[model samples]
Every structure is written in C-alpha cells, then in structure tokens.
Target chain A: MNHEKNIIELKNITVRFDGETVLDNLNLTIRDGEFVTLLGSSGCGKTTTLRIIAGFLEPDEGEVFFDSKNMNGVPAHKREVNTIFQRYALFPHYNVYDNVAYGLKVRHVPKDEIRERVMEMLRLVNLEGFAKRSVAKLSGGQQQRVAIARALVLKPKVLLLDEPLSALDAKLRKDMQVELRNIQQATGITFIFVTHDQEEALSMSDTVVVMNEGRVQQIGAPEDIYNEPQNAFVADFIGESNILDGIMKEDFTAQFSGHTFRCVDRGFAPGEAVDIVVRPEDVDIVKPEDGMLKGTVTSVTFLGVHYEIIVDIGGFKWMIQTTDYAGVGETVGLSIDPDAIHVMKKSKYSGLYGDYSTFSDEMEEMNQMSEELAEEYAEELAAERTEEAGDGAEEAGK
Target chain B: MKNRTFLRRIIGAPYVLWAAIFIVIPLLIVVYYSFTGPDGSFTLDNMKNLSDYGQIFKISILYSIAATVISLILAYPFAYVMSRKKEKTQQIMMVLVMLPMWMSLLILTYSWMNILERQGIINTLLGKLGHAPLNLIGTPAAVIFGMVYNYIPYMILPIYSVMSKIDPSVLEAAEDLGSGSFSKLYRVILPLSMPGVVSGITMVFVPSVSTFYISQKLGDGKILLVGDVIERQIQAQNNYNMGAALSLVLMVLIVLSLALMKLFAGESDENLYV
Candidate 1:
C-alpha cells in the first residue's frame, strides 16, 4: 500500500530477437514492498519483461533504474535482485541445506551465520527438517519451497518469480498462491511475478498489468481491472464478458443491441463508437413479459454454484450466469443495472472476443488438452536427450 | 501371454549366442591359457614370471596415467567451450571431433608417426625455419602424445554430452545468487559434470594402458609396454601362457581402477553407464 517512491523503473524499453520485436516502447515502474504481476498469454512478453528485470536479458533500447540509480551495464551477479526460474533450477548435486546456503557461501559469509540464516529461511518456507533431503527426492511443491528459500535467503531487494507455481497441480497452486502472498507481506520484499494465468494474477496481485501482443492493455487493482477494464482485450482476458459494439449517445448514456442503456462511463464525444462490456454474473433473469430485452435460451450448463445459460438475442449470443434455472428453448428476459454496464473506447481487440457463438465446453477442454500435450512432448524430448547422452557415454566407455 | 514371452525369447537368441561365442568363450580360453603350461598341465610358472617384467609394467602404468591426465586437461576446456556454442556450431564441432575416429587406429598412429618422426613434416618445417632439428621421435613424450591424440575424442564426447545437458537456467540461478563465473564453474558445473569426467578417464586410461600400436611406432620399439610384450609372447615366441597371464593382469588392473573411480564418484555411479 506504500506508493511513495519507485524501487525500479523501466523507461522506453525495446527488445528485438531475430529481427522481431518482442517488447516495444514499454515503460513500467514498481514500488517497494509491492506485489505486482505481469499477466498475459503465451508469447505476450511477460517472461521477457521479467528476464529484463532480472538482468538475464538486456533491452536493445532502454534505461533501467534501481533505487533511482541507472543500472546499465550491471551484470546479474552484481545486482541486488534474485529470480526463481520456471523449473525451480536447484542444483541437483546439492542437498536442500547447501542449495539454500549457496549464495551465502559464495559471499564467504561466516559458517555459523550462514547456517543460522539458512535454517531461518527454511523455517520461513516451512522446510525446517528437510535440510539434508535431496532436491530430486522432494515433491514438486517441496522443491518449490526450497527454491523460494534459496532465493529469499539472500534477502534480495526484489524477488522475481517467473511462473513458479505453474508446474504444480491446481489445488497445490491455489495453496501456494496464498502462501506466496503471506511470504511477501511478512518479508516486505518487492515481488514482481510473471504468469499467464489470469485467475492467478487477479487473485494474488495487488496491481495487475494486463498485456497483449507486446503492449500493456491496462494496469489497475484486481477489482478495478475486473469491473472496469479500459479496453476490450482487458475485459475479455480478465474474465468472461459480453462485449458488444455500441455508440456513446452522450454522457451516462450508451446504445447497444438496438437498445439504449444507462451506464456510469462518460467523457466520450457525442455519438462516438465504443465497446460495451457486460459481465455474465451481473445480468438478472426475469420473465419475458416484464423484461427489458427478451431472448430465447439456447443452452444451459450447471457449474456447481450457478447455471450458465446462453441466450440468443437478435442473432447474438449472450452468456448469463445465475442461480435461476432457465431451460433451453424457453423465452427469458435480462435485466441490467446501470453500474453493471461498463463502456470503453474502441480498441483493436474489439470484436475479436466476447462472443459465445463458437464457444463450447469441449473447445476449452481441447485447448487445455493441447497445452498438456505440448508439455508432454517437451518432457519426452528431454528424456530422449538423456537417453542419447547415456548411449554416448556407453560408446565412449567401449 | 505365454506365446508372446516365447517369441521374445526367440528374438533374443542371436545376441545370447553371439555373446557366448565371441565374448564368453574367448574369456574362458584366456583364463585357461593363463594357468596352463605348454604341455597342457596346470602350473604357476606363468604367474611367477610376471615379476621379471616389473620395469615394463611400471613404464606402461606411468605412461598411460600421464596420457590420461594430459587428455583430461586438454579436453575439459574444449568440451566446455563446445557445449556453450549455438546448436549449428555445436553439431559442426561434434562432427569434427568424431571425424578422426572413423579411420583405422593403425592408420591414425601411422599418421602421427609421419608427423613426429626425425625427418618428418614437423622436423622438416623446423629445419626450414632455421632451427636445429630436435629429436622429435623415439621418446617417452612422443609415445604419450600418440596415446593422447588417438583417445582424446573418448574423453571429449562424454564430458561434452554431460555438459550440454546442464540446464542453462541453473547457471542463471547461480548468477542470480551472486556467483562469479569462476565460482559457478568450480561449485556447480564441475561437480555436476563429474560423471562424465570419471567415464572419460576410464575410456582413455583403459586403452592407453593396453595399447601396442602407438608404442611400437612412436616409441620406436625402445619404450616397450605391456601390450607389446604380450603381443611378442603370443605371436613371436609362441608362448600363449605368458601372454594370457599378462593380459589377465592388465584386465584386473583396469577393473580395479574403474572400481576405485566408481567409489570416488559415489552416488553418481547411476549415470556412469548407459
């Protein structure tokens, strides 16, 4: 909550690889003891930004300032920052104790002090008696704790975590999210996390910076980002939204889906083209005769807490999530409050999302399946390389 | 299920037969000859005669150890450099390392002889450069040089393979934790690559200790090794008993050294073999 001064600043940063721009004219600043997340999809340059901050990468054109001092030409080892890699790159040869003590040993800290600090960090991460355990023998979650302890033992000014929990199961990931937030608050170290999971970002980050295609779409608190997205991409990416093309009639008024509605957004030119965002949970289901806009329910799915119904209104599908039961082929009406309707200026991402016409549960499942398959393929490739190396060793032995 | 098991056994019959014929039978024959006399009776004479060639044994052990150490020192840095290159460059460098192995060992040793002989290419070049012609061949150094040059690829391959498999992120993590380049290598890279180093030493030392061709040509027959003596006893002197005895001793020595290495490597022995 302390927004007094900037701990780190990146100005006009541009990075190009193989003649392709990965980050373009990007600028960002982080405050001390803040938990900021850079959220985006794959190839959206979130990891690249984290790497730039970690000093593993250098921007082609940019100025990086740490504590208000220009940090150009500083190597990663000379900086006061540490990174937790995606795979928890612990030294396989070292046990948990040695891994945590590596930094202290490299600095030639006193042995007794090193042991005390290492044990203290282990206690912080809840790995007290696991100092002698081999890293490979530990479970994924345990290894994650060791990696955290290793980096935080150095007491870095800033901790950069690049999707540290992405490899864990869903339930464990949720637990770690809360644990990570507690750790950040307890230690009061600046944490700059990078992840592609929007839900993870929204739940954990004090400030979420939504990114798309090498550009910052929006930056705000989680509630503000979810409720009042500045653009169509931010609205669609943050959660499910019913985005429709609309015209701003005047201040506090908008027209969409052949009906004018009252909204809280304003300051737009008269009759300006815009995008209107309607959250699925904000719409109320009513009888068709007493409703504002009437529609026929096309599909209904029970989602544990609510029933998600897709309604067809004037040939456009609108998703509504409510506890009310709406059967398919039944006529229904939707009621929208003025505060529930969010309006924004038109962006390049307009019309690219926010439609449920081609959406299905199977399609979402298929997307998850493909991601799992890609992960499996990468693991298989690594196994194959290890086998090849084994074969090479045998041949050399012969 | 029974039928599939039968089929699997049938498919594996050839390898079993090949091992019994080529490997197992030959070893048994060596063991037999090692303990028998010329009259086909058991005797301890052959084992006792080994003490007479103590000098040859010492020379062979010393030269091979020297060769193995030199190869390791030269190949570690080279393999480390090669492993850090881009993929395309790494492949090219790997191919270059293996290209010399495709030729015959005798041919390679002959080539080294031509390069190191008194009036060969190196001496000729030195003479033309207005320097006195140094004694380039028929020395212990030339024999060690030949052994190193011929077997260095074995040392490089395993080390390079293991080094290349080291996750780049681990090195980055080391740097992130405030380790300089030297500390990173000494603490992280070297310890991780120990399996490769142990295997490389084994691969280089085994053949160098038992090699006959390099010492014969490069040593000018003056610096005889255990292999040369075994070869002379079997082919020229027709003394298979003494030859088998010497061969058995060499095998025992190699196995002992390998066991020592595995012990030193500790838990990393899981990765010592394929």
Candidate 2:
C-alpha cells in the first residue's frame, strides 16, 4: 500500500463504436507495483479500459501516458506492456516452451538465453516439465498458466489480464486467484486485471474500481469500498444490502422506515433526501418489544454458515442474515448500531436496486435462463444473416 | 430396434447396388482390358508399349505442374485478401470467383480461344492500334493458361475458408508479444494455413494432369497430352488395351504424388478438415 509515483495515466478517455458511446469521459491513474482491478458486469466497458492500457486500443478523445511519456500512436508490439487475452490465446501450433519463448525469439535473442528464460518462466508458472507438451492438450487451468508465463517472459513494465480465470471451474478459479496474487506480488510488475466478478476483485485487488454504465462509480480499497459505498449501485453491486429512501434530518441523524436513527455519515443539508444502505449481516435479531422497528418473518433459508431470513417491514421486504433460527410465520425484531447504517446521497441509480420483494432462488435461475435465451436469439439472427448472404451469392452467380 | 436396423439396411441398398453397377464393374473391366490382347489371350505387349509414349508423359507432367504452380501463385494472394474483407464483401468476392465456373468448360475454353486467337478480338484491337498481332493461341502458354483459369476457384475456395476460420485473437496475441506484421505471418499464419495449401494443390494438380479438352482446344492438336493420347486409343483407334494400360500408369503416378505431398505435410493432416 505504499505505492507512489503514477506509472500509467489516462486523461479524459472517451471511446465510441457504431455511434454509441462505450466508454464515457473517464479518467484514472495507476501507481507503481499496485494490483488494480476494473470490476463491473458485462458490457460495462471494463475490458475496454484494459485494452486502452495494453495499447491494443487507442482512445478516441484522450491521451495515454506511460512512465510520464505520451503513448499516442504507439503500436502494441513496441509498447512495454503485455496482455493475457480472455481465452488465453496460446499458439496451438507451438509447444509450451516455444509459446513462452515467442517474444524473445522475435526480438532475435540468443538461443541459449531464450531457453533459460523460458525455463525460468515455466518454473514460475509450475509448468517446468510441460515445455515440450502441446498447448492444445493442457487443461483450462494449465493453459491459463501458460498464457501468464508467455506474457511475463517478456518482462514488461505492466501486465494486463482480461478475465483470465473466467473459464475455469469454481474450485480451480479460487486456487488460481491465490496463485495470481502471489505471482503479482513476487514479480512486482503493475498488474491491471479486469473482470465482472466482484468477489474476485475484492479478494485479489489492492485497489478496486467499481464501474457502471461506462462511468466510474467508486474507487478505493476493498474494505473501504465494502464498508463505505458511495451510491446505491456500489452498495447493491458489492454485496447484499437493504437500500431505502431516507431523509437526513440533521447532523448525525437520519429518518427512514418511520424511525429516526443515528448514523456516522454527515455533511448534508437539512431535510435532504438520501439513500440508506443496511447490510444483511450488520443488524441483530432481538425481541419485538425492545426493537427499534418491528417486522414479520416471511421466509427463511438455511445457508451453510447462517440463516437468511426475509422480513416484511411496513410492507417492504428486508433480507437478514443471522445465525439464529427464525420460523416463516414468526414476527421478528431487528436492531442496528450507529456504525452499521450507511447513508449515501441520492443518485441516478437510486430506487433501481436493493429490493428483496422479488428475491428468491428461483429468480436467479430465471435470470440465467433469460440470458441463455438472449444468446441463442442473437446466434439465430447471425445464422439467418449468413444464410441470406449465401443465397444472395448463389443468385448472383446464376 | 430390430425394425430400425432393418430399415437402415433397406435404405442403403440402392447405394450398394449403384456402386457395383457403375464403379466396381467398370474398374474391373479396366483392369481386365489392361492385361489382355485383341485375341482374348493374356499378354504384356500393351504394358511394354508404354515406353514409347514417355515423351508425351513428360510433357503432360511438365505442363500440369506449370499450371498448378501458376494457379497457386495467383490464388493465394487473392484468397488472403478476400478472407480479410468484411462479410458482405467476402460473399460478393466468392460469387465472382464461382461465376466463371457455372458455365460449360467447352464454352469457357472457346471464349478464351476467341480472345487469344491471332485473328480474333485481341488481334482486331491490335490492328486498330497499328501494332503487330501477337501469336497467343495454339501455344503451350495458352494451354497452361486455360488449365489455370479453369481450376483456380478450387485453389481459392479452400484457402479462403481456412484463413477465415483463424481466430482473430491469435493474431492480436502475436502483436502483443512484440511480433511485427511479417513475423506474425511467417510464424503463425503460414503454419496454420498449411492444410489449406495442401488441399488446394491437390485439387488443382489432379484435374490439370488428366485434362483432355483444354490441351485439345487451346493446344490445337499440337500439344499431345496423355489425356488426348488415351482418348485417341479408345475412341478412334479402338485400342482399349493400350488405353487401359496408360490409365493404370497415370493412376499410379497420381497416387505416388499424393503420397509425397502427405509426407511433406506430416502432422498437419490431423487438422485437414478443421
């Protein structure tokens, strides 16, 4: 965390495709030897930012500076950066050693030196005995390590990884996360990782950058980002939270759900509308008579570590994670401390998320089904277009 | 399940019968005719006579090899450019390449004859421009040009399909790893496209070597290829024995050449379809 002296700076970057803006006017800076992650859902411009830093893409309306030098018009090969593509992109024709040594061989490095460096990189990625093995035969996790070794063998000043662990199974993904963090630390090269998985970002990154709709929502350490979210989007995206419309009454006081509560956040005008974020694990279950607000328990699910209960509070559903057992028909009370309630200013994302009324295990399945359906629909459209073009070719030939 | 198996056998009966009648029977007849004389007695006279047509075999091989090489040189760059184009443009280019193929080969060669003849369209244009008429028709070059024009599509289609299937991310990865344009092509693209090159060479070489019409129409009876000699023996001279023997030798030659090509393209054979 003692990082200083910016290594990469992006100034007012904007990118557009097909007359639609993919990345808005954005600005960011990376320090030396810092593990930074751009976390967002799909189509949120996270990969676009990584491409800009890797020199594969040039911003339409901004300047990029690497090591305090303007990097405009510089090609990817000439830049002191390497990227691990989303699919690993290992050369199928080459073995592991040849793939890792490709960059050095292209630069006409000595054959013996190439072999030595390639073997060292193989040892780093734990693929020392796989030098002569073909890349196509390796499993997904092994291929990912080969990609990492190939990029790091160049010894670039920066490494950009675009969702490198996304293709692995869950257990393998976790193992690789720890391995990647260790590799980044050992190499001390500035690592810029992009992924849509917030948990991965939180666990691996020294600095987490939350993005939404092509704009930066918040940027801070993982703890700060989790404990102190700036808006409803960050709070809901990071973890489960009960977001409600509240009003700031005065200094250190907020009014929401027909109860006035004391919170730590301040510096707001009197009687201003704001959003309140209460984490599911922060509140404590207690007796109904001693509770600040009373609620009826609607549903309870047995998770491994805790029980997740949904309560109806003044016709609004609130999700609570607690270790105590609560029946579906029982009325429960909840209590919160002053430090537990987080208040945020109203933003464009307010009232859009953080509602548990439609929350269920079935909802997640339905969302997955719809996503698959949408992908199938898109594939059908592409197939139809290709068929039509083929018919046109036949007709023109006649 | 038993009924389904019976039905499958019934459906495949026609193909088996057709192969017996048209393919297997004709091949047996060819083998029989190659070993017998006109008097219906086994003899090696026809096989021994093959040495007399050695010069014709050499000329045929030389002309077809030239045709195959020229077609490859012309089609490789064209297919590479087409593969790099957008989908719409690529489809249009494919149509243009196949357009010349839909017409009859005789008609296409006849049209080339009209274009390349001394007193034809080119000569007429040259006469108008006050330049001497260049002799183009009835030359070895004309026959080779005709073979190349007729078979170039076969060379282009396979190469283009293979090149277009290359994952674009692999190229970007090469660029990211400090490879320039030429290096990327030499190291990655050329090796990956070897399967297509082999298939294209085979497609062009097979037909040009055994072609009778192109050399007959464009060579104007001067360039006697193996196909023309075989046609003369079987149809005009009624010498089926010599024609069948010549066909057997030609088949052996083609098979040997294909085996050589497969040896050169050793491990890439696994991904030939891919």
Candidate 3:
C-alpha cells in the first residue's frame, strides 16, 4: 500500500469511449512481486483497467505511473510491461520459438542470447521440445502456455493477463490456474490478472480487487474479501452467500427471521437496517430442538464432494452446502454461529438477490459465458486458418 | 431439420443438372474440338499451330504481370485504410469497389479509351496546363492501365476482408512485444493476410491475361495480346481450329493461376473461395 513498494499505480484513472465512461476515477496500487486480480463480471471495467496499466489504452482524465514515472503518453512498446491477450493472439504463421523470440528480435538482442532466452522461456512453460511447432496447430491450453511464454520472455517488470484461461475447458482451466500461480511465484514478477471467476480469484491471487459497474467495491486480501465483504455486491459476487434482511437492535445483536441473533459486526446505529450474509459452507444443520432456526428442506443436489441443500425458513430460502444430505420435504434445523453471521450496510441492491436463486444464476451465467467465449474463439481460429472471405464478392467461383 | 434435408436435396438438383449440361459438356466438346480438324476428322494441325501464337502468349503474360504488380502496390494501402475505417465507411468503400465491376468490361475499356486518346481528358487537361500532351493511347502503357483499373477491385476486396478480420488484439500484441509500426505491418499483418493476397493475385492475373476487349480497344491492334490473337483467329481469320488451340493455351494460363492460389493457400476450401 506504500508508494515506495508499489510497482504500478493508477492515479484517478478515468477512461471514456464515445461518450460512455468505462472507468470512472478508479485508483489502485499493485505492490512489487504481488499477484493481484481484478475480479468482476462483464462490463465491470476489469479489462479496461488492465489495458490502461499496459499503456494500450490511455485514460482520458488521469495519469498512470510505473515505478513512480508518469506513463500517460508512453506507448505500449515503450512501457516496461507485457500483456497476455484474452485469446492468446499468437502469430499464426510463426512457430512457437519465433513467437516467443519476437520481442528479443525487436529489442535487437544478440542471436545467441535470444536463442538462449527463448529456449529458457519455452522450457519454463514446459514446451521445450515444441519450439518448432506452429501455434495454429496447438491445442487451447498449449496456445495459452505459448502466450504466457511469449509475454514473460521479455522479463518485464509487470505482466498483464486478460482472462487468459477463459478459453480452456473446465479441467484444463483448473490445471492452468495452479500452473499459472506457480509460474508467477517462481518468476517473482508483479502480475495483474483479470477474471470474472470467483473461484479463480480466491484460489490464485494474493490480493483481490472486487469491482462492479465500473467502480471498485473493495480491495483486500483474498481471505479478507471473502470473510468481510464491504457491501451486498461484494458478498454476492465473491461466492455463494445467504444474504437476509436484518435490523441491528443494539451492539453485537441483530434481528432477522423474526428472531434476534448475535453478530460480531457493529458500528451501525440501533434499530437501523442491515444486510446479513452467511456463507453456505458455514451454516450447520442441527437437531430441531437445539437449532438456531427450524426450516424445511426444499431441494437437495449432489455435487460430488458436497450436497447443496436449500431450506425454506420464515418464507425466505437459504442455501446450505455440507457433506451430509437432507431429503426434500424433511424438516431441518439450521444454526449460524455468531462468527458465521456477517452484517453489511444495505445499499441500493439490498434484498434484491435471493439465496437460492443467486448461486445457480451466477454459476449458470458464468458457465454459459465461458462456453460462449470459447466457442467464439474457436470459430475465430477456424476463420483464421481457412480465411472465410466476405460474401461472394469475387468473380472467381472457387 | 429432417424435412429440410429432402427439400435441400431437391433444391440442389438444378445445380447438378446445370453443371453437367453447361460446364462439363462444354469442356468435353472443347477437348474434342482441339483434337479434330475442320472436317471433323482427327488431326494434329491445331497442335502444330500452337507456335503461331507464342509471341502473343509472351506479351499477355508480361503485361498482366506488370499490371498485377502495380495493382498490388496500389491496393494494399487502400485496403488497409479501408479495413481500419468505421463500419459505415467500409460499406461505402465496398459499394465504390463493386460499382466499376457491375458495369460491362467493354464499356469500362471504352471509357478508358476516351480518357487516354490524343484529344481526350488527360491531354485536354494537360493542354490547359501549358504542357505538351504525352502519348499514352495505343501503347503498352494504355493497355496495362486498362488492366490495372479493371482488376483493382479484385485485389482490394480479398485484402480488405482479410485485413478487417485480423483481431485488433494481434496488432496490440505485436506492439506490446516492442515492435514498431513497420515491424508490426511487415511481420504480422502481411503474413496473416497472405491467403487474401494470393487469391487477389490469381483473381486479377487470370482475368487480366484473358481479356481481349481491353487490348483491342486500348492497344488498337498495335499491341496484340494472346486474347486478341485468339479473337482474330476465331472471328477475323475464321480459323476455329487455331482459335481453339489458342483458347486451350489461355485455359492453361487460368489453370496455372488456380494452381498458384492452391500453392499459397493450401489450407482449406474456405481460403480458396477468395
């Protein structure tokens, strides 16, 4: 958080495109050797933030700093930063080695040094023997690794990755997530990764910057972001949360579900409204007589490691994930320990998201979006190889 | 989907019949006529006459190659600029490119004739500038200009389409890797658009070499391209046998161009479409 330790700083960065504000006076500081993720859904200014840092998109009303230098007018090439584009964007005609060596060649490095660096980078990505292979012939994950290799071969001060794993399959996405985190740690270079995947943000990043609607909701450590979301959107976006309307009666006591419960969060005036969030994994089901609240099981789904069960209590649905299963229509008692109860000041979107609907809705939307992005990229790759000409605008029939 | 399959097969029947009747049969008849004499008897006379048109063939290739090179030099930047423009501007440029192609080739050449003549637009404009009118009409330059003008759109369309489809991120990727503007263009944009460049060359070269009207009007019989010789053989000379032989030579030229396209874009039918 100190200026001396920050590798990149965006000072009141604002970007507008065709009269629409994409980034509205956003400020963020990334520490040296830190892996920070800009976590947000679509149209949330995450990619725009990454581009401004890479010096590809200049902010309309603010200055960007790299190592305490003004980077407002610096072109992308002049900046000591590199970006792994969303779709890899590898040179289709170049082999893996040439693609990775392109930067060295541009910098006029010696042939021997270029070869050694390229080989080292390829080996780093575990593609040592694949230097001669055409990138067009590579699989999705292989191309992604090639992209990373190409960006990191320069040994830049900062590396910006824009949803680099969105094109891979589920299993490969998980594998690359771990591989990427390990690579970043090994290199010890500052990384600015942008993704809409909450699980990826939580698992991979040292610091997570939660964003929504072109504004920074909160920026903190991954655990801090998960445990203490600043508002309703952060609680909703980070993970599955059972958010309920509650009233703060007094210090450390909150009223919800037609009953009073103890909560650790305070500072709100007495008799004031608040939003309470309880993570699905934290809520435990207990015996009816010894439970905090009694509810009836509405639905149960087996999710391999855990069973996702929804319970209806006081006319509100609550999602609970546990190893134990609950049959539908069975009466179940739920207990939220004092620490599991989180209180947030209600914002404009208070009580807008239901517990049962938000989880599946978020999952479905993200899965669908991930698939669509992959499919479009696949089509673009096919188009690249086969060169689909526009219309039948030529006299040559063939 | 199942119901549409039957109807689709039915819809395709007409194209099958048309190819068999028009394309396949005509090609077979040309092959038969190439081997026969005026009396419809098998002879080697037409093959023997192939040497008579050798110089014309040489001239055709030279002029078309020169025209195709010039067109490439002129169209590359134009197409690149068009590709970088807004969607509305691209549409307008496309309309302008296709406008010249829609008119009959003969009319276009005649219009060029009007411009390149001794007392025509260029000369009249030069006379107004107090300079002597230069001779361009009935020269190789006039014929080459005609070919370049008519075939310019052929080169522009494929290149523009390919350039516009290039992911903007690829260019940014090149820039991010410390490439200058020239390096980005020479390394990335040019290599990725090679398929379009190949198709454009083939499209322009084949038609430019085989067009008789432009040479006849602009060359005015002073410069005899192979197409004009073939026309004279068939119409002015009444030598069908010799014309068919020369026509076969032109066919070889077209087939060779197609083969060159195949060599450069050996990837798929989608690339071959351009």
Candidate 4:
C-alpha cells in the first residue's frame, strides 16, 4: 500500500514569470485528508505555487511528490488529483449530470456505474435535481456546485481549488466557503486551496501558508500565523498592524515613539536597530499619559465588531482597532503587551510594509512634507499643460 | 405598443416590401413553376415528370454529397493545423489560403487545364518518361478534382473560424479530466467544431450542386450533371420554362440540404455563444 499520509510534498519550489521571481525557493507538505490553504496578496505566487502543484505549471526548480512518488513525468490526469478552477470551467454544452459523468466515462467505467457515481456526487454537492439541466442554465452558485460535483466524482486523493469562490458574490462566496469546508470534512479528502483573502483562508484551512514574492513567509495554524507572525511581512499580511522603528536598549527593552516598551525577546544587542510589529487590535488606546506611547486619533472607522482608529503617534500614523470610540484629533495613549511586539531583522524584503517604528512625529512630518511637494508638482504640471494649450490655440487661430 | 410607433412602422415597411418583392416573389415563381403543366395550365405535370428529372436530381445530390465529404476529409487536417498556429503564422497562413480567392475561378480553371490536359504539363511529364498520355482530362476525377481544389478554401475557412474559437483551455481541461488523445478529439474538439464543419459543408455543397464551370471546362461538356442539363435546356435547347423548372428543383434541393445540415450539426445558438 502506498504511504498516502504525506499525500503531497513540494520541496524547494521556485517559479519565475518573465524574469520576475514569483515564487522563491519554497517547501510545503500537505498530509492526506488535511485541508491546507496557500494565503497571500495578489501577485504573491500563491496561485502559481498551487498551479505548479496541480501540474498545470512546471516549477523552475522543485520536486513535487505524491505519496512518496516523484511526479515529474506524471501528467495531471495520471496523478491522483483533480482541480476545481476559479472560473468553474464547466462544459457549456453538457448538462450537469453528463459533466459529472465525464471523468468516469473517460476512465471507461460502465455506463450504469458512471450514472451511479455521478448521481452520488450530485447528491453530495446537493445538486440532485440538476441532472438534466444544462450547465449554462444554472446560476453561478449552481454552476460552482456542478463544478465541485464534476471534480469530486472521480474520487481523487487530493483536490486542488484555485480560489474557487473568487467569482461568486460576497454572500454566496461566504456560503460556498463554509459548504466547501463541510464537504472536505465529509469526503475526508485533502484540499489545497489557494486564495489572497486571509479571512477565507483562516476560516477554511486547517493550515495556512502565507507567501510573498514567490517565497513562503510563514506556515502555521490560522491562530498561530495571526497571533504570532514570523516576520514583518507575515505580521502585515495576516492582519492590520502598527509598526514602529526602535533601537534595542539594555536588557531587551526598546525605545520608540518617545516611550520605553519592554519586549519578551532580548536577542538584539544594546543600541542595535530593529522593527517592532504589533497588531492593531493588540494596541490599547487610553487617556494621554496613562499609556506607554502618546498619540492623537486622526480618524475612526466602525468595523461592525470593532472600531478601527487611525492615530498619529509621535509622527507615525498607527492604525489601531478598538471597541472604544475616539473623536478625531483627540489625544490618546497607546499601550502594548510586553509579548506583543514582533521584532524583524532588516532585509531586502523590508519597505514592503512601510517602516512603522521611527520617530512617529518625524514620520508624519516627512509624510506631510512629501504630500505638499506632490501637490506643488501636480500644480506645476497642470500650469505648464495649460500654457502649452494656450500657445496651441493662438497658433491655430492665427 | 412600441411596434405601433411611426418610426418603427416606417423602418419595418421597407424590410417587408423587400422580402415580398425580392424573396417571396422568386419563391412563388419556383413553387408555381414546380406545379405548372407543359401547356401553361395549372396541373402536376412538372411534379409527375419528376421521373425525367430523376437523373439530374440523383446525380446532383450524389456529386454534391461526394464533394462535401471529400472536402471535409481534406479540410479537417488543414483547419486543425491552421488553428494550432501561432498568431502571426496563423495570419500569414490565412492570407495564403485567401490568395487564390482573389484570382477569378475561371482563371483558376484555365490554370488547372494547363496542368491537367492531355499532352499538357502532367501528360508531358509522363510522356517524356515514355508512358502514353493518361485520359484523366474528360473524366469525373477531373471534375471532382477541380471542384475540390477550387472550393477547399470555402471548406477550410469556415472550419478554421469555428475551430479557432474553441478554447484551448477546454482541451486542456479534457486532458486533465483523464481524456486520452482520441477521446479528447471525439468528445471535445469534434463536437465543438461542428458549427464550422456544418457551415463549410453548406458553403461547398450548395455551390457545387449547380456548378457548371468545373464540369463544363474540365469534363469537356460530355459529362452530364444537373448544371449541364440546365445549361443545355436554357442555351442549346432554348427551353427557359424547363430551365426555370429545373432551377426551382435545384433551389428546393438547396433549401432541403440546409435544413438537413442544421439537423445533423445539432448545435444550438447558445452552444455557439458559450
């Protein structure tokens, strides 16, 4: 028997598009019956990685293993996996039942058996009465359900979904996401979903692999990736964060935003530069002088369950979400838990998320200065264009 | 309510007039001629005299069907290859295929004569090699050959247009769904390209049924087809009524062929849009 526990393993995966590296050397392992989600921003190579795993694309340098077998020569059909594309890709001429029966028919299964399996798959996807209905006759949500039935009827060992809900409306997308998770549970099949939406990844995936610029930044459970991000990219990508540039003081305390904050780890030597990443929800807003950092609320947004507050702390604008409402321009204090700060080393991948920890005041001053300069440049360009147009009008009239 | 508007009525009047004058008039002429007798009386003489027209009907139908089937066999491969070409190459190839169409078919027929005639280029080459000149000129082979060569573009172009519109992703999807080469061709490519094949057959067959030029020029006027019979009746025999009657018969055959083509293709308008 094949050792199917480690159903899919991608080692040192790398992909490039027109000389731009989309996936750096990446490694991932998906266990049998485990639901994994590749989560990242658009252009982060998460979909590229998924396509490579699905055998639609070949990695520049990597090995994809299925059940300990090197899958280099195995075509997508030969491999024990099926994909449900984002567009659904249903055969327009075929009815729902015929589409589901296609894979079985290709396998040369008996006609009666193909019907039985197709019927069963339809039932599984809750599309029982849709057998004779043409695929084009179905709504988008129904078409997606037909696509699910079509892919699942083959009983593949692993199913790859490339942002299957991305085409649906918001309510339908959410409903389908839950239904997808429940279906995966019912089938007990491995599902590797690729998506840019973090909340969808968090909701559906047993393990979330956050990627950026073709390299995986972090891979962990949803809660772990959110609560304890590995790097600055992860922290920013997984959720909203307030970053601060700070210098490590004696014994692991860092000074930033005109306040001293204690941190859990003390690896950095005294006077060394580092960046502190704290999620917006983790920062406590309070009355001035009663917190570690001083700030003024610039804007407040109600996000249904919480309030998202943009605060000007020292000169840096920090977005902090709280249940407490604060008026614009109101003075506020910022307090972070000692273990909340995530320190990141300076790397080329920095500047992707704006440098959060510099003097908050200096950062705001620089931002305002840049904004003023930008306005002046735009005005100058507009004036020059108007002058050119005036000269042209006179020339034409003459 | 909108149908009663002055502008709508004004616009619609011309179309109805045109249909009645140009289309319905000719169709009535054909139907009347089909039912008219030899003495200009309203009788079923033309219909009863179908036995006399049987040879024309059978030959035209058989030859047109044969030509369509042959053109399909030839065009399928060309269409497949052209559709698979890169964009620039496909454009260049399309231009090349359409180049012959720019030249008159009569001119092309003369060119074929130059190559196909006895003691012509083909026979000259064979004779130079010490064999007798082959009697290929005044044969059905020559007629079919000329028909297929001239109308091949008609077959290929329509098939190419239809085949090229088929999504490559659908083919790939089929492969990923475990379809081997044969099954993929039969299941996906062939079914999807039926519209083109249907259009191509209609294009080649309709004109081929009444095509007198190829049979006249290539068959040396000895080979009897419906086109030859019509030409003889109208020009040599000086029987316009008989010619018009036969013309009506051919028109009816074309209409019937069109309906048959639609039935055989079995593709809906929705399938084409998709």
Write model 3 residue lDDT over A1-398, tens digit each, in one string: 23249888888988888999899999998899999999999999999999988878889988898888998898888889999999998887788999999999999999999999999999999999999987877899999999999999999989999999998999999999999999888989888999999999999999999998778999999999999998888998888888999999998999988879998978999999999999999989887787789999989999999999999997788999999888999998888888999998989768776467446676868989999999999999988766545334343565
Candidates 2 and 4 compared: the better one by DockQ is 4
**Best lDDT goes to which candidate?**
1
lDDT of 1 by residue, A54-90 (tens): 8889999999999999987898999999999999999
Give per-residue CA lDDT, model 2, range B110-152, as digits (tens). 9998998888899999999999998888899999999999999
User: Residue A211 CA error for candidate 3 (Å)?
Assistant: 0.9
Docking tier of model 3: it is acceptable
- C-alpha lDDT of residue A15 in model 3: 86
Which one wins by DockQ: 2 or 3? 2
Pairwise TM-score winner, candidates 2 and 4: 2
Q: In order, what lDDT does every prediction score?
A: 0.93, 0.91, 0.88, 0.83
Give fnat (model 2). 0.70
Comparing candidate 2 with candidate 3, which one achieves the higher lDDT?
A: 2
Model 2 CA deviation exceeding 4 Å by range: A359-398, B1-21, B270-274
Model 2 chain B: worst 10 consecutive residues (lDDT sum): B265-274
Q: Fnat per model, in the order given? A: 0.76, 0.70, 0.72, 0.48
Tens-digit per-residue lDDT, A1-398, candidate 2: 23788899999899998888988998899998999999999888999998888788898999999989999899888999999999998888888899999999999999999999999999999998999998888999999999999999999888999999999999999999999999999989999999989999999999999998888999999999999999999999998999999999997999999999999989999999999999999988898988888999999999999999999999888999999988988888889899999999999999987779766436867988999999999999999999999999999999
